[model samples]
Target: MHPSKVELRVLGTSVTLQEHIRKRAEQDLGIKLRFVVQDGGSVQRDGVMHPDRYELYDQWFHSIDCLWPTHALQPIELSRIRRWDEVNALPRTGRLSKAQPAGGAGCVPADRLFVQADGTLARKPSERISMLPLTHNADSFVYLPDSMPASLVEGEESWAWLLAPELAGRVALQADAAIGAIDAALAVEASGLMRFRDIGNLEIEEIDGLIGTLIEFKRRGHFAGFWSSFAEAAQLMIANKVVIQSIWSPATVELERAGLKFRLARPREGYRAWFGGIGISRLAHGRVLDAAYEYLNWWLEGWAGATMARQGFYISNPKQSRAQMSDAEWAYWYDGARASAELPGPTSKHLVPVGQVRDGGGYVARMSRIAVWDSVMDEHNYLVRRWTEFMRS
Candidate 1:
């Protein structure tokens, strides 16, 4: 942590860097830098730091951290870190330390560690996978009974249920423009199956929290509706109001344990999927760039993809998904994993399809595409402003 009197000024256009590095500095150096300003500045161009100009700032700053939102970190830091042969020679550290369950109950390690399809996990010398730790109460609690009926399984009527009738009027969806939640709602309108009523009209004694938003809807004779963050949504689902939630695979597992029935909604509706690829950055000082590249290559080679797929996540390497997973897991991720390869282009088949996705056997098929722009750094301001308008108004 920085010294109490250092009065450090940290100004950056990156949130991940701000959060991670600031916390690290506070913990390691005992210093809390007075953050003077942080804004989307002209200095950040196209989310790429120009070397000639950025090097000066790098020198002034103690450290720098940057990443591409849709993909992985850029090559700048990789290039700078590579020069430190000593850092490279140091033995690999295993995965980040696991947190003990909060309140003395043991924590169950997440079954599948989230890894990037583009091989970010492979770049590290360490063998264990990386996971973003949840900051909330980490303790495991005895949950609601897990009694999913066989009818709710593969062959049941409503097997692929999206939203339940109980949820009709009572939902508060937290949404950003990119993931297309708004479009889905519009589609529902187009289908004429359901009509939405604004929350203000609901009569409730008091509505204070997120849970209250849901309760108010149900009490006023509506199914509360709202989009949710991965962390909080998982907890809510376990408590049992969310009949169906739009979520990624990692969040999906947490809900599944709650026995609150779910299935893919519109995978083919052109939603975004987070993808990552490791690359050398111009800022990496030493041979770290080479090491990072080597690691990236290993991940793409095969085993990494297969292992990740078994965990219900898809990889850039289709062969791994096809060869490594059990038939059940494969069927879960893709309708016909082995046969998907026999189709003209294997990778293309698994990619989230754009527009309408056809019903392929039992799977909710969708094409996958990586949005190339760096929204994490460059466009977050616009997104936040829009979100504020959507919510506060």
Candidate 2:
């Protein structure tokens, strides 16, 4: 019989928030916290959830309570990101401050706006965060590693580089495995660099499921390798199953904590980085939600950026966390450590930015190619169709 999982309804779209709560709840209550994740935003009558609404709902929590830990490693400051528009635009960036306030015609304050940059943001603060609508949220990016390092020297080569026949069944993708796998397949079809047979003998699973799957495969001596989230993938390495897992600088912190020995190797293609952030939930327990707000506030502090910098990831706000950091911390966060790979972001290199919060302490940089969860669902839907076709054929 399944134990009744606590459906503790709290608000926010930040996966870290959920993770924190789950970890805390389990430690305190001795019960597993099962999260029923909804998009972080207000209710929409659009007959569908609006992305902007979700972003706002997430930020609303930041206003009420600090949902994120002040000590968490947010590469950017919410306040600094909010006021980005007043300053010069980021290198190859776009803007997404388009929505009006709820039940009002005037534009939401600039502090609440979201922003997206192609590569990364400028190294310094430009203006006050009090002027923007919301902080910037970074989106996650994906990349493919090749054994033949020379095969990938260009960052813009496309997602096909991951699909060689030698890797067909052996390859594991992140969240977008179905489509990412297909993308790899299509890449192979187009490039004719490799030919793969059926995956009849391969083990496949979603990215989240990959962790357990990899563990299981390791126990059974069937492990190949994996890719996906930077944090968990690093943990996989700690477990010694991540022979060649996908990772980012944030994972480096976890690696250090776990005392794991690993290094980011030079890729045949250039390195790639994905941007992503948390959103507050409009539909949630106000108090618990307030705790989430507190967490976000904590993230905006200078110490948080220092933590992030020490961990190897870039914080959004370069200035707000200044007081919390020592000169040595700042040096380590920005210049002291080397990134795994200096690569372009995963978005189309032409998206806008949005999500300004906390007097410019942190922000979310929107994707150049904007995709809601629905788009991810759509890819899964197509994967189902392909699986159906494959079964029929």
Reference-based TM-score of each model: 0.41, 0.42
lDDT of 1 by residue, 1-393 (tens): 214433333223321123433454455444443332222332233224443222112110101112223222232232323222222110112112223111110011121122345544333332233322111110001112233334333332221123334335423333433332233333342334433342111112211222233333345644334443444546556656544444434344455444444444332222332322223233433333333333334444444455444324444345434665555445545553333322211122333222222122322232211111112322334433443444443
RMSD, one per candidate, in order: 16.9, 14.8
Task: Name the best candidate (by lDDT).
Answer: 2
Name model 1 segments beyond 4 Å from true: 1-169, 172-177, 180-229, 267-280, 336-364, 368-383
* Clashes per candidate (backbone, < 3 Å): 50, 88
Candidate 1 all-Cα RMSD: 16.9
Angstrom error of the Cα, residue 324, model 2: value is: 2.7
Q: What is the lDDT of residue 127 in candidate 1?
A: 28
lDDT for each candidate structure: 0.32, 0.34
